[model samples]
Target: MAKARLMVVEDEAITAEDIRSSLEGMGYDVVAVAATGEEALRIAEKLKPDLVLMDIVLKGGHSGIATAGELRRRFSVPAVYLTAYADPATLAQAKLAEPLGFLTKPFNEADLRASVEMALYKAGAEAERQELIRKLQEALDKVKVLSGLIPICASCKQVRNDKGFWQSVENYITEHSEADFTHGICPACAKKLYPEYFDQLYGKGSGGTPE
Candidate 1:
């Protein structure tokens, strides 16, 4: 199987390299690393990583939470927050970004592995679900099922559409549904309309095949 691609968004160079080393050891591809929220967003736009390991506090105008939100909105990328500060206020703001997982600062290899795996799994499942919904909607859109009461003329055998305009049965059905028409003369109609060739064509029976 292909390794999952990841991006590290940490302002500290040493911490970012540590995270990258851990991820690479865990069989994940660290595609890029960014030192600021703005840089993270810029790299994410191009790399479109499967998951982002983001530092919640960074030295930039845009916070990690704000950058995470933008990554999700623009590229459908999910995030696993890395933070030393897990205070209630910071967590409250982080929740708005809907991060898939969280790893406290000074985390071990096992903690990193767990958080990254869970985030990748959830992101994949959600993407599959969205694609399934899109396919089902497309199928429903393509199907045209006719229903409800129809107003049709008894003598002419034509139908009245929603606009109150009368049309032939074949034309109405063809327009309102996936059905198409192929013209053929039935035995009774053929005998009645062309008596001269009835016996030769139908073998003198009510519903006979052409000889």
Candidate 2:
């Protein structure tokens, strides 16, 4: 199995190196390390890594939270924040980005492992869900984007097959699409064909003639 590709977005050089080393040791790939929020976003767009390890604060005009949000919005990548501050205010700010996981500073190897594992698992699940939705939408679009005007027999209300044969509308539609039909009678048709039944239920002259 391929190792999960991870990008470390930390401004502190030493900390970034440590993070990269730890991740590599854990059998996860450290694809690229970015020291600024701008650089992080650029590399993320280019590499499309599976997950990002982000620091809440970065050395740039933008914060890691903002970078992570844009990454998710544009590329659908999930981020795990590793920060020293756990203050309610800071966490609340990070919450807006909807990070997949968070690990506090001074974390042990186990904490790192747990955070990375959980984030990767959730990312995998989300990716699977997105793929399924895309496939379903593609199938629905194919059905909806039916070919150009269909030739039909106006009198019989039947359709002309591509093979130059006449076929019922239901059969033609069924053959050309993922659709099924259920028969039902409209009020007009019911009144016209079943006049006795219609009169028994609703007195004569209660409804207009069928078309």
Taken over the whole model, the C-alpha lDDT of each candidate is 0.91, 0.90
The count of residue-pair clashes in candidate 2 stands at: 0
Which number leads on lDDT? Answer: 1
TM-score of 1: 0.91
Residue 130, model 2: lDDT of: 86
Best by TM-score: 1
Which ten contiguous residues of candidate 2 have the minimum total lDDT?
202-211
What lDDT is obtained when candidate 2 is compared to the true structure? 0.90
**Residue by residue across 10-99, what tens digits does model 2's lDDT show?**
999999999999999999989999999899888988899999999998887989889989989998889999899999999999999999
Alpha carbon lDDT at 190, candidate 1: 77
Q: What TM-score, over all chains together, does every model reach?
A: 0.91, 0.69
User: Once superposed on the true structure, which residue ranges of model 2 sit more than 4 Å away at CA?
Assistant: 142-211
Q: Tens digit of lDDT per residue, candidate 1, span 20-70?
A: 998999999999999998999889888889999999988889889999999
